[model samples]
Target chain A: MGKKVLIIDDSSTMRKIVTRSLRQAGLDFDTILEAGDGQEALQLLAKESVDIILSDINMPNMDGIEFLRQKSANAAIKSIPVVMITTEAGADILAEAKSLGAKGSIKKPFTPEQVSEVLGGLM
Target chain B: MSWETHIADATVEIFSTMLMMEVSSQPPLTERIKSHQDSVTGMVGMAGLYKGMLAIHAPSQVAMTITGNFLGLEVDSVNDDVKDAMGELANMLAGSIKAKLSDNSKDIQLSIPSAVCGDSYSLDYQPQQGSSMVPFESAGGRFLVELQLEQQT
Candidate 1:
């Protein structure tokens, strides 16, 4: 089966960087998707399916926490895995994300090896 | 141990690890620079236990160069990519400083990143408790990371 990944981030630069990092990490997917925020990601997920999600914790409009909340409520997309890519290293928020179903998190200014080490097991 | 060192270390780490560029930090600025010419500024605010702002100011050429390095492309103008790249850099720097400020992540809250750039501009802020600006030299050029903070009583 072909794998698809959706990246949610307000910064277009960061999205591009993640796409490049996934490539650098050698985590190749059949299709790569993007969204500006959780709202956009949810909307996209409603019509399409992705194997996994990589989202930023801080974003305008809808944030990753709310996205996780809403996704967990929806049975259709609740099972898909999510990983946070953020600069927020606060244990409280990351713990919240874990409780909400975030598989893992990668901080900003992360290296390719770090990304791979986290996502390798999940992928 | 100072805010200057924190800002300097964060900036250098971001550039070296994320942007794949080696940057060197210079001595702390003795005076604040309010005006900028052909430059871009990326800023994020912190509220709650700590209240202040983190800003990164870079010349237009240097900003474009940094943006290029960020996205692995050649950038020639101060476009949206440059602004977003700069804002993300500010976000990362603020996050690092926030970690040093307190163990509880919820103690401080960071605002969404913002960017401002043009031919000429000036940013004015009234410092309450502590303020520091650190300069750095990258392959592109020199840039400064400025932080203003006041701990709530």
Candidate 2:
């Protein structure tokens, strides 16, 4: 079976774009699930098993950093690598996310090749 | 590159790469308003190091075209899809410009994007000491990107 992936972003349009980009990048995934924010993603994780996560940093509730903090503390879901796709241009934020155990990050206006390159090793 | 150049470049790249539309910068307009009667505006605010607002404004028709191209579907009018697409564009543009600003952008915090649509409306960045409005033309339509920064205390 192909790996399962979870995509989290508040914007449905962005979620669709990320999904399409992932497919275009030729990532083999059997199923792709989506959530609007980190809080919702946590709820989804409670029931589903996903190999990797693609998330956005700025969201209405439970931003990516806090979500990562919570995820890191949980033994069950801590190992699932998360790749942040966000428009946050702060190097400090990026460093903070990396310190929190994010596998990688792809900035906005990114290409499919960039997405594939970032997630290839992790996934 | 200067902030104006960055905004122009990012706008073109986003439209070209994401929406598959070709866009070129137009001369700066004295009046910030560049949209037609019916238009949509996407706005995002930045805080911390560089406090300001970034906005994208497009006529309803242009918005529909962008929405359609982004979603890979034919959109006949302005709807949730168009608003969402515009908001996403604003977010991406702010982020792209933030990156180009180098270390000065390290502490900047971006607000969630907000959008508005109407036949006639006005936005004032009052109390803002510095601002830049850049216009671009795609095909036959014109849209704008404006950056307003708060005056340093």
Candidate 3:
């Protein structure tokens, strides 16, 4: 068993690419669950435990920041490492995400190697 | 230098590297407006030092093909993976173009990539009338690259 990974994003395409990148990088996972937004992710997290999370910033129901805030409030969820894969690279936003307990960050248009390097170190 | 020529250079490099296609010519606007364009397009905007977007407009089939190749998968339909790949391509290309333009303009900030998909769409910059439109045909399908901008004169 590699690890249980949770992917949060509004776009299914993005989730798939991240998933594909993980597989391509040979990161094995026993389970992979996806949510359309932060609230959905929270619901999933309430029931199951995951080792890592790969999330996007912009979303409808709830965004990555909200997700991180909520995660931080919950002791059990807060402990799991989070890797934010979003297009927002603004320094303020990056600093906020860092403060919210994100394990690391990767910008858009990332390659498998890039994804590997970010999460590989954390996980 | 004209916006048309600059767009051509950017398109050439993006088409070759990202799409793995070659641009034999920088087709005219009339020819571009006339192509059987894809209905859905993924568009991204920029501002500051460098501006404009890298739009990937493709028909349903073509979009799927490009997305599939990008993810190194065999996709038969439009999925989250496909859209993400298209959006990310726009980001990558825009980033690359920003890098290339660094030789001329070094201090530009890039906005996060945004996307829009529909039957038909158009992307343009303000300071109207001057724009560069580059059309390309790849194994996946035909697409266009436009570099619309306003240089402080």
For each candidate, C-alpha RMSD in Å?
Answer: 0.8, 1.8, 5.2
Error of 1 at B33 (Å): 0.5
lDDT of 2 by residue, B8-127 (tens): 888998888788889999776666554447899988998876688899999999888888888888999788888999999999998887676556544677899889999988886663
Candidate 1 C-alpha lDDT tens digits along A8-86: 9999999999999999999989899999999999999999999999999999999999999999999999999999999
lDDT against true structure, model 3: 0.69
- Candidate 2 lDDT tens digits, A11-116: 9899999999999999999899999999999999999999999999999889999899999998999989999998875778878888989989998888889999
True contacts kept of 3: 0.19
Q: Which digits, one per residue and each the tens of the lDDT, describe model 3 over residues B45-126?
A: 6666655555656676877877766656688876656666666666655655655555332255554455666555554445
Q: After superposition, how far is residue B56 of candidate 1 from its true place, in Å?
A: 0.4
By the TM-score metric, which is better: model 1 or model 3? 1
**Candidate 3 backbone collisions, by pair:** A12-B80, A13-B80, A13-B81, B38-B58, B38-B59
Indicate the TM-score of model 1.
Answer: 0.98
lDDT of each: 0.93, 0.86, 0.69
Q: Which stretches of candidate 2 lie over 4 Å from their true place?
A: B34-36, B102-106
- Candidate with top TM-score is 1
Better of 1 and 2 by DockQ: 1
Q: What tens-digit string does per-residue lDDT give for candidate 1 at B1-153?
A: 778888888888999998999999999898889899999999999999989999999999999999998999999889999999999999999999999999888899999999999999999999666899899998899999999999999
* Candidate with the greatest lDDT versus the true structure: 1
Reference contacts recovered by each candidate, as fractions? Answer: 0.90, 0.75, 0.19
* Model no. 2, DockQ: 0.70
